[model samples]
Target: MSDLLRRVATPCIGVCSTGIGDDVCRGCKRFCHEVIHWNSYSQEQKRIIDERLDQFLVQVMQDKLHIINAELLAWQLGVQRVRYPAQKDPYIWLFQLLRAGAGQITEPRKYGFVVDSVWRDSSLMELREAIDREFYLLSQAHYERYIGRYMQKEG
Candidate 1:
């Protein structure tokens, strides 16, 4: 999703909590400053932000699911019109698929992924919520460890 300048786009989902002074946006889990400066950031900065989010997703997802067919996963996301960054790891697109259309997905295999047997009892929507919760917590912790220290020192 290219923004005005055709650079790397924001991850904003429009449910931003940053305006209310949250250290992290509940929607995309971006630090408030990251959200505020996203459009002004160089492509490299944007890529770093994206990779951080992707790494967090990888942490939370772990072996809970696996992408069996990268092309099929990409195709499914395209077919669903899920907004995801282009040229990223297929797992990023997998997260986008779950975020946008988890409820509509009943069978993981058909979507070119496999839910671990231990997680099979949970629905995709449930897994999506779990992932979102964990991701947000990780982002909040990161802020408190890094950015929050500087903020506290200034104030």
Candidate 2:
């Protein structure tokens, strides 16, 4: 079969609870509308959305973790049996790294990462909390902007 004929797998982390008023998916960080309409989107459109999510993840994660050698990191992930999206986004890998390493991450450089001092100094739970807070704020802002346009149009 042609590669183009194969559909790209959805990045659904399986925590899809978009039934509420959440404008974003908590697991994958995809916009709720994007999640709902994913199966209907053309490959090019899906790619575009994936790229946007990648950009957002990188923007948020770069402040907390720095990737050194992406190839080495991928190798390490394989060795550790850590599951993450296979996309080229380093930030997603970093998320997996953080989850896998947690308290065990004493020398992040060895894992091809350099976590922020704030994260490095704190417990993994603390880091996770901070990341969640930041991501939630970002999602809320995006939701307001997206919904505001529709609200404005109706008024």
Best candidate, TM-score-wise?
1
Candidate with the greatest lDDT versus the true structure: 1
Tell me the whole-model lDDT of each prediction, alpha carbons only. 0.85, 0.75
Residue 150, candidate 2: Cα error in Å is: 1.9
lDDT of 2 by residue, 29-105 (tens): 77778889999999888877777666766778888877888888888888888887765687788777676666676
Worst 10 residues of 1 by lDDT: 1-10
lDDT of 1 at 100: 82
TM-score of each prediction: 0.86, 0.79
Give the number of colliding residue pairs in candidate 1. 0
